[model samples]
Target: MSAPLRVLIVDDERLARERLKDLLAEAGDMQLVGECRNGNEAIAAIDAERPDLVLLDVQMPGPDGFGVLRALPPESPPAVIFVTAHRDFAVQAFEANALDYLLKPFDRERFRQSLARARDRRKALASPLDTELLARLEALTRRPPHEPERYVTRLVARVGWRMRFLQVEDIDYLTAEGNYVSVQVGKQSHLTRETLSALEAKLDPKQFLRAHRSFIVRLDRIEEVEPLPPGEYVFVLRDGTRLTSGRSYRAQVQRALELPT
Candidate 1:
């Protein structure tokens, strides 16, 4: 009979480590050689235990999972399956040729799938470690992929001592007051700590527009754009809110609203 696959669990959370340990125990073909709470300990444990597979967490206090990978000598690094909560790291993890990227709150079937991949790699390759892949992984760790600018999908707001989550799509407009902006979603309004310019930059330009210096209205919510005097215009919302456009932002607003210049 083939020997059991040696495995190591590395995570910052004690409960997370314990949970993985229990799951590993259920995998009859795998053996838990060691466990590490943080990246520093993970490095030491990897060298000492020489585990065949590492279930590594990406985020940690010091020397993250990537750091452990960087510190390892090229001789024979163990196969890695990155365990992370954030989905943003998925692409890079797979690009590094990881056994699998297991997102947190995963089921037993998911865990087994990652374990099977690790076992398959161990049997297929002469050396479980791929030095070239490690090198590429290190490079990626140093200069991680740049996260593209993303619009706000949801906004957390305070309502009479209770907190409420406001969906961006549900918002009709925003009114700037000093350093704070009142997010108007339908009939209700909620305030958030943000500047108009800062909030504008974070919103989808196609969906929203700076209708006025103090007002930002959802383009789809505009009932009509009423031409005021001398190049200025007032945007009438579907819900009957009228907001005037700023002189400096006239061209962009007109273009966005498909108004004739």
Candidate 2:
């Protein structure tokens, strides 16, 4: 016998939202406090209700799931379990050390497994630091650094004949454009001269992750990581553009997290 687990559901798709809600209902012991279609609304709900857990979707119109998590204060943030369809984005999700994931068209068992993991993670922690954990949680969620010893002091991208400097913290995500890598910061995009592989070596693995063969993301700025069909995952940043993840690198990304030995 224990207290009913309070939960919130966030997703952009109406059907997806309802389906998850139904799944939670079947479990019987959990309470469905409410649902939101986007991250902005979800954040408001989180601020007001302060639920114990959030079944968050990676992609949405504004303030996607990751955005909601980022916006949360460290003092009392909720445990997050992502419900997505993208396989590539799994790397990012694993980086976050997510409790579990329920792929789309979820069955009873998958849903149950997700809830079980969430419950276990919640129970394992002696005390929760909502805002603080939210801040540190990015380390586990974004692409890990290349080596623990080295961190990105500053982001340098080769452009044409000159190199431009941007703080690593300023970048939202890195995208591959043909033979180039794009530094996405806020609303502007800057071109860099590097292939995805070469960039991986130069960029710190702890802060930047290779999500897809062509895409790498800054851990702190990721707004959402969603699952997609045809064997792939997609991620959306705070800027509202969606990108795909690389399926092959999923395991490598997971290993970088260096979870409990």
Candidate 3:
């Protein structure tokens, strides 16, 4: 007989966590091996138990679900189903190849659907740590953690709260910040959990334009580009916010914008 799928529940809310456990208990196909209330705890449980699936919450006290995901080795990806209260980050979650999402106030049927999908996908796969999986994740995440195919969906800002969710659409540009990438948004800039190269892959490139090694702009948000100096231009945003264009990205950005060279 096929081994029963093992699952780990990671959520900050006690009631939500217990409720999910109860839902799983009602079903006979999955075995709930462990439950955690925070990312830190979830990481420990994941490393020790190595569950087949993880029901991860996007928000938590510290080292949130994304942190727990980052903490794991890339080779051992546990199919993740995001349980989030915030709907704005849904696209990013799915972009990360999450099995499914259970918004708050989840019903039994929805839970079952998500669980079934995870199981079916798992059954169709042969091994987790194989090269094909690694390449797919690399193409998605741009880098492999100890667990390939996993990229951080949240950020631990350098000078603020321990956790924050900066959706991919919220990003206006990407700038290399040493080992990480600084994501520019409306008024506040956030440091992401992934490298610049990784963000390039994980992000929907059609929306984001890599203007420079240290700069990327949202294509739809650009208002105009004005010639400034030799092979240099000024990027005017939809909001009239302007930034200097990087030298290297001039031709490429021009090509994307369909501007005369």
Candidate 4:
């Protein structure tokens, strides 16, 4: 019969990787070629193993799922089934493109269906990098210079296996934590995998202020600003959270607050 379909699993989470491995074992006529923990590893494995199909996670420590796909060779790239915890606009894009994706915490029946689709796609030798799909994905990731910038009204926060959309207006502050940002909304704080500067770019300048190298605070949330020595100041928020300004941000903070320089 036909040769066993070679597959690679790429995900940062150990549990996720294990789950995929278990499911792949049940998927007859498929051989698990390798497993990669991050995007960089996934790229290396994809290049080395040349697997027929890949199960790639959307978010990880290094380049995300889209980044990995972008790095692949244009001609005859491996078929992909995205594994994502997000139910955002990207999901709609995937659907529009007729691409297969496994939403987080998916059941066995869904997994089987997605795998069957991948098998059919492989048999048909369908090129995964369709021009329209790539264009749509690029559009989702970036905006054309001619297009007016549209700031995000909501941010997706992953809680366990579920995703929740947090209104940007409800965010009181954001702080950098390695590769992730801690979004503070009143007493609740949700962690999302986004750089502080990247998130800053999406925020309205009039509503948010970069108070420190690691902190961005909502302008309206500042209840008090206590002056400190040598151009430093401690800001108290409506939620009673206090954040000290970084030395380099002092001037900007002053201008934002219209305080005497």
Whole-model lDDT per candidate: 0.76, 0.68, 0.70, 0.76
Q: How far is candidate 4 from the true structure (C-alpha RMSD, Å)?
A: 13.4
Question: 180 in model 4: Cα distance from truth in Å?
Answer: 39
Clashes in predicted model 1? 0
lDDT tens digits by residue: candidate 1, 1-261: 678889999999989999999999998899999888888999999999988899999999779877787677534567789998988877555433366899998999999999987776555443322457544433332223465646666665545434466778899888764556678876556656557788898788999998667778899998988887777888777866666677888799778978888
List the candidates' TM-scores in order. 0.48, 0.48, 0.50, 0.47
Ranking by TM-score: 3, 2, 1, 4
lDDT of 4 by residue, 159-196 (tens): 44344667888999887744556688865666555678
Off by over 4 Å in 1: 126-261
Winner by lDDT between candidate 4 and candidate 3: 4
Q: Estimate candidate 4's alpha-carbon lDDT, on a 0 to 1 scale.
A: 0.76
Question: Worst 10-residue stretch by lDDT in candidate 4?
Answer: 89-98
lDDT of 2 at 9: 91
Residue 169 accuracy (lDDT) in model 2 = 74
